[model samples]
Target: MIYKAEKFGEKYTTRWDNIDVDEILSSERLLGNYKKCLMDQGPCTPDGKELKKNLPDALKNDCSKCSEKQKINMHKVIDFFKDNKTEWWAELQKKYDPEGIYLKNHIANNRHGDKNDDKRDDDKKKEERDEMEKNDNKENSR
Candidate 1:
């Protein structure tokens, strides 16, 4: 699947099968920091150029700042995934359920081995959310 970036939202989606799980997981971790870039500072593209140019001050705010750390950390994480795709993919497959087929699939596919329990719990939450959305649609249609 192609990962498309949203206009205003920072979220993107790619095919689960096509994605290198380890890379995706790494990217997910980095995305949290990217989110910090947006929330604390302002919008930024993952491409790094924008963050480098527009938000230099925000980027250099402080090491103690999660956003600052995220900015720097994301670069290393992204670089590692790009350079070590095969190794990362292997690790991801070994640790995660690629054929998730559930709500938790979204989060689970991106987390390390120890987080499966949390993934299961997240799946439950997603199921509930889905059910609520369905019910809401039904009510609206009535």
Candidate 2:
């Protein structure tokens, strides 16, 4: 069966029956083993050279047109994993694990933030927090 999870306006989909139980179990175990590594990671550095990688032409066409906050958030997420690769892998394992995962309310909540500005504000705060943490890491490393 196809299962979907939504979070922060993004949708994640998986097939329950088609996946391997052994793989899931192994991923969970690995994640548990690397929790500490994930927590200690730092932010990624800025790269403005323009990427023609990993994305389709349609999506990459106007990459530079993305908002400053969007760019920063993307970089921060990348940096976080790079700094804590093991932990990040573990967290991803947990996220993908079938038993503990909860489905996100994608249908009920729209991504546009048209229903309320609260979601926008919350996203902004999260971005700010990520940026602040990145800056703090840079300061500490100096």
Candidate 3:
């Protein structure tokens, strides 16, 4: 799981700023441990726990609290998963973005280059509208 640095008071601690992201991504063992930790399938290191605690807020707010360096690192992690570890990326999205809200933003931002993404989003919106119309019609009949 990519840790989107969260603000502690004014900014997230810079203690992790110098972390070698490439080193971790290259090591399957290290990355797997993080995946397990984030998925609640294994014990968490302190930093992993902190990251889990912050993840929901970061996702909801588009990492608004993240520093520029943290945002850069987050994007690097996201791209790595998308390009090299697509299945794992899907798992992460299923867990964190179950409603597809964040994924829509990613597609809108061209983070994922799938041309059909917009059509899927449009279909979902139409389905939602149809459901709402049905509910309104039922209410009016009653």
Off by over 4 Å in 2: 1-62, 86-142
List, residue by residue over 71-141, the lDDT tens digit for candidate 2. Answer: 33333333344334645635543544324222122112323323334655788899999999999999999
lDDT of 3: 0.74
- TM-score: which candidate is best? 3
Candidate 1 lDDT by residue in tens digits, 1-142: 1123245434322222233434545575564444344344445554433443333232233212223334334334434443455455344333332442322332333344226446667999999999999999999999
TM-score of each: 0.22, 0.21, 0.68
Per-residue lDDT of 1-142 in model 3, one digit per residue for the tens?
Answer: 3353434555555567777888989999999988898888999898788778877776777666767776667766777786688898898889988897766665565544454555667889999999999999999999
Ranking of models by TM-score: 3, 1, 2
Shift of residue 120 alpha carbon in model 1, Å: 0.2
| Candidate 2: residue 134 lDDT (0-100) | 100
Question: Which candidate order results from sorting by lDDT in descending order?
Answer: 3, 1, 2
Identify the superior model by lDDT, candidate 2 or candidate 3.
3
The alpha-carbon deviation from the true structure for residue 125 of candidate 3, after best TM-score superposition, in angstroms, is 27
What's the C-alpha lDDT at position 73 in model 2? 36
Candidate RMSDs in order = 18.1, 17.5, 10.4
Note the Cα lDDT for every prediction shown: 0.41, 0.36, 0.74
